[model samples]
Target: MDNDTLLMVVAQLGGGSWVWRRSGGPGSSFVRHQALGSGHLRRPHAVASARLGGHLYLGVADSSKGGTSTVFRWGSGGFYPHQTLRAWQRDTHLEFLELGGRPALVLCSAARRPLVYRWSGGGFAPHTDIPHVPDVYAAKHFRLRGSVFLCLTRFLGDAKVMRWEGSMFREVQQVPARGSMVFQPLLLAGHRYVLLGNDFAPSRVFRLGAGGRLEPAQELPAPTPRAFVPLAVGHRHFLVATSFKGATQIYAHVTEDIGT
Candidate 1:
């Protein structure tokens, strides 16, 4: 809510990998915080999402033979305590969810079968299992009118939409998402919008409507034609973080509300 145009640089330090996030503010060039995570032998274990209970969950695609996952949960004194889950060590994929007034996260295999995990009195526990679909490439969550929705794209180049019915994620009926357009599967803007990037076509904003979907909410204006840049979103603002051509420039997602 400050300068509205802040550039952030990310780096890995001393076996520490962090996402140094910055935003511009008054009298100050930037406001920044580093979301740090533990390092693995080959790749650093990083948290992908955090819950309202103050839990920071780390998600990684465990493709390596010895790959593992570590998720941090908020404990006493506002610090995230690490809780390592060995079940996801092989091919676990992670996504955050807030369904039915409870903060949760979605876990799946590289095969793309989905499972819902909600924070309980004891760390995080399994809530539900989504239908099995192999080789799923991307998954995202969104909400409308207090209902939770989930959308995922498959490796076969298609998108799947599901809605939480106070119990589990069920396939949406009578909706049309090709499952082809969802490419990168990254959640942006505080975990409410789905960003299309990587192999995702149209590389734009996909909002969850009555159900989980990828309908365009906004089309980002590019200063120049480019590709292969990292993207992130915050609430109504979408950031196109790209180091293409060797410079980091961030863009904001806006509709008519930007200049206001």
Candidate 2:
């Protein structure tokens, strides 16, 4: 595949295996098939599917159960697993970002005192401990524009958004910082807006403000967030490859009233 062409990862199913479909040419649609996800005792806790240097990089869990220092990256007909830490952990999550003008894969371990890992020098290395965060016991990284952010849900503490500022993460500017970070947030609306949650009442909306700030923009009228990521490109195209009740679905649309 050409470096300029994008091989959009369609679905991540069956542990390490991924379902990918190439998009291009005229009148072409998403072609589906399976790859990897074989020969494993432990299920993947975190997964990162990205194209770095003309080849796809698939990050997987080195162990199925917690309490093991293991992270695996796949490419070129093989798998490379590394133990960045000594102790065991759980819910190893991965988010790929461009850090310092290079491909950086951030890993967050789910432990009593969780840790963060970065992929560099062709292996996994410790980046730094997230400040002001006692523990990111369960957190996921969100990339808006080029910066990386984490929405951390803490135990017995308030959940906050941590922004990566080339050095470390700081608290995101939230209007109601003390309120509940309830909804399951997903990047949507051409990556400009984020669909926060599907609460019992109504859906809350948030738009990324200038200087990497998150401001309460609008409400979704309904309470359900149907998509996870933007399926198609362009400002007019609205799409989401989402999972609802353990089932996979594709949602797309073209909008006319993009900006007001």
Best by the TM-score measure? 2
> Can you write out model 1's per-residue Cα lDDT over 69-150, one digit (the tens) per residue?
5565433322243655444334435676677667777765564366677877556677767775555544666566676667
TM-score of each model, paired residue for residue: 0.58, 0.62
TM-score of candidate 1 versus the correct structure, residues matched by position: 0.58
Q: lDDT per residue, candidate 2, 183-231, as tens digits? A: 2345555456544444233445576677656677665434233334555
Lowest lDDT sum, 10 consecutive residues, model 2, at 174-183
Candidate 2: the clashing residue pairs are 17-37, 42-64, 67-88, 67-89, 68-88
Quantify all predictions' global Cα lDDT against the true fold: 0.50, 0.51
Worst 10 residues of 1 by lDDT: 221-230
Candidate 1, superposed: residue stretches over 4 Å from native: 1-46, 51-63, 74-81, 86-93, 173-195, 198-260
